[model samples]
Target: MDEAVKFHFVVDGNDFTSAGQASVQIKKNLRQLGIAPEIIRKVSIAMYEGEINMVIHAGGGEADVLIYENRIEIILTDNGPGIANIDLAMQEGFSTAPDNIRSLGFGAGMGLPNMKRYTDAMQIDSTFGKGTRISMTVNL
Candidate 1:
């Protein structure tokens, strides 16, 4: 492709049922673009995790996907209470999700870790009480 293809989505914070819509759509779009299944899988997983995080923590957010020749990038931005300790947040099995959220089997503290594990590169920018932005890339 001469130019990167971009897709944007707005995640609804109040609706847990609709959290993963963006990632599902992205997976379909990537498949139509002839992206490899593995790459698509990685991108979808990372994007989904980010989306869920936005819904669970941030009151809602925006997700953007850029499809380039060599890589696919997913950017998630949220304006909720930002992560206070990114280091602790990244640790496995560490979560601040409410007991109600846990009852729904949503927050397992694996979102950030899984996002990083699935993507070739990941970066997180967060400000306490402000917001957070996460960018992840998967190589084709």
Candidate 2:
């Protein structure tokens, strides 16, 4: 592709049942484009993790996917309580989810770690009490 193809999705924070919709749609779109299954899987997993984090922590967020010739970029932005410590949040098994969320079998403290693990590149921009913006990329 000579130019990037873009897709935008709005995550509904109030609905746990629809949390992974964006990731699922992205997976379908990638498949239709004939993207490799491995690449699609990586993007789906990363996007899904980010989506769940937004729902459980941020209250909601917007996700944007940009498809490029050499890479795919996923951007998730939320206007909820921002992460206080990026370093700590990146650590595996370190979670701030409440008991209720954990009871739902959703908060395992692995969202950020898993997102980073599946993507080729990842960056998180967050301000305490303000918001967060995470950008991740997967090589094509």
Candidate 3:
């Protein structure tokens, strides 16, 4: 596409049923734009993880996606308690999710790591008591 297209969503915290809605919508949007299926899958997976993380830990948040000629950009921001240790949080299988969350099979401590893995570039900005803002880009 010659022009960039943007989409936005509001995530509802602690709402398991609605957690992946943004990703699903994004997937549809990408498909409608004729983006490659593989690319759509990767973007959907990454954004879904981020949305789940926001619900489980961040008490909900906002997600924005921009589709451009050369890349897809995603931004997730939340006012929930920020991650205490970025390095530790990035480690696979390392999670602080509550027991109730684990019972639902939602928190495997794989969110951030997977987000980074799927995206071409990822960045995290957070503070202990403040909040977190994550930005990710996947090359087209």
Best by lDDT: 2
lDDT of 2: 0.95
Candidate 1 lDDT, 10-86, residue by residue in tens: 99999998889999999999999999899989999999999989988998899999988888889999999999999
Flag clash pairs in model 3: none
All candidates: CA RMSD (Å): 1.2, 1.1, 1.5
Query: Candidate 2, residue 88: CA error in Å?
Result: 0.3
- The residue ranges of model 2 lying beyond 4 angstroms of the native Cα positions read none
Off by over 4 Å in 1: none
The local distance difference test score of model 3 is 0.93
lDDT of candidate 3 over 3-97, digit per residue (tens): 77999999999678778999999999999999999899889999999999999888999999988889999999999999999999999999999
lDDT scores of the candidates, listed in order: 0.93, 0.95, 0.93
Expressed as tens digits, the lDDT of each residue in 80-138 for candidate 2 is 99999999999999999999889889778899999999999999999999999999999
For all predicted structures, in order, the TM-scores are: 0.97, 0.97, 0.96
Question: Model 3: runs farther than 4 Å from truth?
Answer: 1-3
